[model samples]
Target: MKLAENMLFKYGSGKVIRVLYINPFTSIIYVIDMDSNRWSYPIPKDDFLTAYQNKEMIEENDDIYCRAVPEEELNELEKQKRDQAWEIVTFFKSKLSDDEHMFISKYRQKAMKETMAVFSISYNGLKNILIKYFKGSQTKCSLIPSYFRSGARGKERKAGNKKRGRPRKNGENAGVNIDENIKKVFKIGLNRYYYNTRKNSLKTTYELILKDFFVKEVIDENGVKIPVLNNVKDLPTYEQFLYWFRKSLNDGKREIIKREGTRVYQQNYRAIIGSSTQDAELGPGTLFQIDSTIFDCHLVSSFNRDIIVSRPILFLIMDVYSRLIVGFNITFESLNSYSGAMVALANSMTSKKELCKKYGIEIEDNEFPFCVPNRILSDRGELVNGYINGSIQNLGIIIQQTPAYHADYKGIIEQAFNQTNIKILPFVDGAVIGGNSKRERGEGLDYRLKSSMTIEDFTKVIIKSILFHNNHHVLSDYILEESMIENNVEKIPIRLWEHGLKYKKGQLRILPEEVIKTSLLPSQSGLITPKGLSFKKMLYASKYALENNWFQMARIKGNWKVKVCYNPTDLTDVLVFDEHGDGPFKFSLLEHLSMYSGKGESEIEQIKNFERELERTGKERELQEKMKLFTEIEDIVKEAREKTEAEKNYSKSNSRRLKGIKENQKNERLLHREKAKKEREMEVILDESIEEEDEFAMFRDWEESNDDE
Candidate 1:
């Protein structure tokens, strides 16, 4: 694709530049570099296309680019906001001169900028106050802000199409009645549009609006009335009802406001949808719920144990029908699909026996589950584009993406998260109240400052929460929660899970370990070179992978895209599946990743970014230069310990990540030692007659004896 506004590109100064504004006339793009420095540079179209072709630049995923401001600048902004917020309000009050402060609604939205130009207040600090104070909230005799405009559509419509009076009523339809019949239809349509949890279309709402207005009979909002309209002859046109339905009686923005207020209406508005009592034919492995939420608790560094850090992210997967959590992961790492898919795959394949043991959770044999769901119901996040979606598709699992904000689609899991958090947070130190402040009881009690729980302990708490939620907490699906115990049916989510396992219609498919590993890990189509599998700008091979000169034979496959799946958590190994000319597809691990053995996926990303910068300057850095760059990064981090470290957010995140890498490397070393010991010990008896000779004794003699050349 050609260069455009908001596209991310590599610059010659070794910076990743994000395009802020592009001027087509001058071919100049205003960009903010990674260091938060701005630049306006002109480039020819040919060069932009060339950069794309060479993969030196990339397009935006979300169509919006942003830059971090310098910390000093951010601090100054906050200071100004604190100091001048009320001053600007006073300035506006003086300008008002006792009369209500009148301005165009358009002007009101942009008032902060104008105020910033005059009195200089921080937008972040003043935003909430501005909304309340200006919108006529009388806080201690403060002047109210009021506005006049065409109608609700003033913002969505073009300035040219604007009319003087209310725009909702098509100029001729002003005499519409709010009679019982009309009001019934109006509400039916309105509920579907704004109130109902279902994602309804305007066409459907319009049809319902017209039909109820003409054909159907229903009670009005008032109990005493039937037909509020005195005459059927005087009733408005079908077209007019359609207009009013869209308009919501001159407040068409009502629907827009509610929708914008909460993007996931499914969870937030499930009661309106009436899904709290509706039960689908669901069981274990029917629908998997996957989502990521930052924990409400703070954490400390693993080594230091005193320094505070930000909340770690929890990626959860649950069985919707049984209300049982299937798999989950807790990491101080960045929230992304990498962690999301890992948890999804683990939920499908890995048992929680080891996890429960580590976390000190006691559960009955059937309390927890490891069943692959038939469908994955999730938002259209990066996880959908990740390996989980494709891998599940191969296993015939339908992936369902609900309309954004429709929480009812995954209500059970949503409620599960809330219940889990509520039960777990109070006992833990440094826990944020998550909008419910009852748990916290102190002044100057910064939860972020009070952090003492390590990531591991936080994980233990989370695991314990999930187990308690699944096994002990009584689920109230399709019934009143209070009545669940009185109903005398199966209560616990695990009981429901056990029942589902025995009676659930769908059969579970268990995949092989190799298949799970191959499918779950991030993969690329690689070419098998003579040395090894050439992948991700690096080569990897194992002794077994190179057995019988398979690498050389792999080239004969010719044009076939060899599938290679590598764990980002460990770049030292990549599992490869390749079909050469003669034999079946061979599955092998390419363990020798050269000097990249101990690198994490994030570090690999760093290297790719560094390479992109070097490529932009028409130069290539060798392995030594690349290693030097990493050293510089390390030195920068070391310097940051004393000079730049504030709270433990980034530091703990980085430390936890490095700790994971070291642990993985440590395991890798142990595995190598074990592998060598196994090689020295492995022996096969040649003949039955020779079986008399002890293989152990022969091996021992061979180990003790030195051979002459």
Candidate 2:
């Protein structure tokens, strides 16, 4: 190839040389040994080219072979030396005329001596300046000082009996050198104090090393252990300790993890190399993040406004590509469960128009489209259930669960929850202010006491907030592609979503709403009885069961159980999947259990518990009443026995006592009838006298008034 100034070539002996200058008229080339900084004799151009062609000399493109030091990187002394060297080189170059042939050794030797005499420098020093100037592409940076080479860089210095560095200015003895024993102490101190979650400061760690390694403890006269420090001159200085500590850490990440916790390091210190959108190949509906958070505000029950319902769980599903909140569900479920997660997923894959309408929210038709994402990323919590994961996978949707405590994997949804809370919690009353920390006696009012909004009202508020977020909230930090920027697309989520649909290859899949709902809704086992299908202690009726006479057959043969699925938020109906592949059918609550038609699964369970408690109380009362009746019978029997014993003389024989039983019974019956008739006559006479007195009382008072008149 072409030969240029400062080009490096490797010789057969593995020696590298840099081209310095060339004489075109004389056809001679000049080069210098890069490693030794020694000049080589001039050679004819044809011989150099022949050597290069024969591979005896190979060209090297690596700049490190003969790299020049930048002038600005030099220190003050180095800068002065560079300037002096440059001035001498400039004066030497002026001695040769522009048209003169300077490749000859005779001319170079004569000019070098005159330059050395004019600059008051040695011949070798002046010659070295010229060589450096020519070797570094004839630039001023080539003359920079090489004073850094005086110190042994990247090489360990041997320790002597005397102190290694500069003497102390405080008139005190300098510390000892860091030998192998001191290095062992440093390792022990770091492992015990520095590289732990205790978070000891560096100075503190150094002090601890002094106490544990340099000092000795002994019992004093009072039997207390007292610490005694070694001589100051024998101990290593803090600077030496710090230097060795830093040098030992070749892998900084591992040391950081050791000092801090894994969670803290991963959350705050680790490098975030890629985005979820890029991971999904920038395709909309390709990846979705799902998570649940407890709403900060307490809500009231819809049926009874005075009843305070606890904080509801809010599940959010977000599209990673556009940062759009695709679907959400709000319920009074205290914890995240498979039912709540599945309900949220179902909402994500279906249209939100009807749901918004139910909450009295009107929106544009295309505001939030039905998005069935190909993959869902979530934490290893409720979504890790085998049944739910298996069912989702069967429907061709992948469920990816992140490792425990790594919420950043699903950061999109986590951020969405924070944004929603920031938008709504400030305005809502009864919202938890700090968290569930106990109030100091009477320091503050309980948030539960201030609750006023019903669950329905709270739901409506959430719906409006989500609608505003999807349509208006600006994604200020959203990264846009070139095409989107060219089209002048706004950073609003809805605009980004529309743009993605137009230009990006979407991974959205559409299945029938029923299919998705059936696949995602949580399922349970139920039994078929003569009355109806029993599920969660509530009977449900279905058309298929009635038509096939399953209940009647259960009465004759035996009860058979069937696997059914139902929504936990609404226990009004259960879905029974047909074994014959006829699809699932709905089972409504029986007419007698209409009161529980709209109750949640938790509410139904509470009702069942209350009924059990009531039955227990009734049993207790019934036992007391029965015991009272038995005590009365015992008292009557005791009285009869005592009367017989008090008579002392006579009890009639059995035959004699029974001889006139029928005649005596007839006489007693006649006496009893006459006595009852007389009592009725006496009651009638008393009623008549009272009625007559009441009827004439007004007339009697009138006659008395007339007499007075």
Candidate 3:
């Protein structure tokens, strides 16, 4: 056995390439470029003849003779020596039978024995050399020998330059260059008997497990040295313990459970009694929910003022407990934000008395109980939301912004607006209710003012109508049936009282006469006389409602208009003036009567009859007026004379004939009376005379007596 020629090559500058292999049977070792996959000097026939061979190579107990035998040596000609040697020999014999084939046949057997090729050297040296060779050379074989290395290096350099430009200088010292890519290696071991044992199949060596390590040597049951191996599975059967353990070393958790797989339970949140709920006992003016809605009243637009027809905004404060709309404002413009809405809210929040004094509205104490409201609740409209989010605390009012889009949060106010706008406003034909769209009929001034009536006239109509609605329209609690049942009707009752209201009982408190009398003052005594104020040539009541420092609240012009309501307990009484210290006028009930005028014969006759009645009473002025009325009537009849003298004469003749017939009837009546008197006298004479005188004489005497009488 002997070592063959060895070479070290550098493809580019400062790059060492080594080829290494081991012939285990011959104890021969080959060292070459580590980067190149090829061995130096075609490996060797054996290590017994290398320049580096020593006593260690010759005294090895492993089969060194296998490399020493010429017949067992490998030929460098074939790429694969085991199966292709015979094929290579046959090909050479056929192609070169002349001189080349004969020369090859003579030394083929010797070359085959001389080359028992393999890789050898320390793992570090092998890796370093391989790195250097691959970094510089393209072909693994080119890094093995000088001849192949020179040719391959030229081609790679030229190609690389063409592709990537000329090579640039890298700062590395050639002789002692360190390859950073080199990885550490471990030694695999086997027992002598197992390593030398005969085998039918190729065995792959498995890396040492716990079995290879002997923490401390121990004697077996038979006093033999033995090592320990932990064979039991360390985890539950469901999991791969080793796999999870290895991952846990890197990930810190043995079991990686995704958050998506975990269930999260949420807590139930209920309004707390002393917190979200009211702590104080509810009373009148305890709570008010302020909000705005578009009222349904529609009006026509005046000519030339035809802006985009818009529904007016109606802002109102409703008593939550009572469901009463306490204070409200009707505007012909959209609210847009909290500016106007807050104005309405402030107005609604103040007591009617305070408000009247402040705003100069003549509202009374009774109205105070009706108008003053407490806490305000509202949905998250921009105005309500802004108030809640901004400066509500400064106003000293509790504001609760209803959850977005949840109508039930402010159900009471919402329902109040609905009932007020939808139910009541539609009845008035030309009412322009604020907070409603103007798209429908009867919405604007053009529709409302087109009538003969003025805005003031329409205001009167609106006040009367709205009063009727408020007094007569039955209000209901704004709560679901389920809530009602849960509270056992107590919640509704409390809420109603807080809003300053009560539902009507089915039975009336008194008889119809009493009801009417109590409802309205008597016509004569204690009558509220309307002071005359002329408008459009017609005298109307001034609505001097607030008097003696008293306030009277009433709806005027679709708004809450206040006046001083007064009454004087006397018929034909005049309203007193504090400034003059005297009565203003003889304002009586007659002022309230409906005014009318008439024409034609029927009207004239009525006047004549009225004057006659006055004359009988001996009213001097009335009597004079009656005489004047009669004279006027006679003149009118005389003025209706027939045309032409012949028609006049005919009328006169007809009148005379009628007169003659009347006189003739009267004369006949007188003659009949005389005849009746004569008959009575003759009867008495015949009784006295009796049987004497003949029948004929008696008959003649009777006839004569009748004639004479």
Candidate lDDT scores, in order, read 0.54, 0.73, 0.36
lDDT (tens digit, per residue) of candidate 1 on 1-709: 4332334566454556554333444454444454442223345556766776877766534211211111111222343442254456655545543211223234443655667667555765455454333221112112211121113312322323233234454445433444456656667667666454565666666555555555535487786546343344445555655655544353433454464445443455422322322333544666777777777877776435665657777778877667678877666567655644564465545566755664576555355667545566665562546335544543435567656567676677677778877787778877786553233555655557667797667777777777777778876554423333454547677776655554542334343334445545555677767766677777766565666675667667543356666655445656665542111133433445444554445546655666687686655446668889999999988988867556546746656766778789999999999998776666432453366667767987887785631
Show the lowest summed lDDT stretch of 10 residues, model 1. 63-72
Model 3 segments more than 4 A misplaced = 1-281, 300-309, 353-363, 368-374, 382-390, 430-473, 476-709
Q: Which runs of model 1 end up more than 4 angstroms from their true locations? A: 1-279, 301-309, 332-339, 354-365, 382-390, 434-445, 476-489, 524-543, 546-563, 567-574, 578-709
Over 4 Å off, model 2: 1-274, 279-283, 299-309, 331-336, 351-368, 385-387, 401-406, 427-429, 452-457, 479-492, 505-507, 578-582, 614-676, 695-700
Give per-residue CA lDDT, model 3, range 198-234, as digits (tens). Answer: 3211122122322343134679899998665332321
Please provide TM-scores, in order, for all candidate models, with all chains considered together. 0.38, 0.54, 0.26
Cα misplacement distance, residue 689 of candidate 2 (Å): 1.7
RMSD list, candidates in order: 33.1, 27.9, 51.7
Q: After superposition, how far is residue 383 of candidate 3 from its true place, in Å?
A: 3.8
Higher-lDDT candidate of 1 and 2: 2
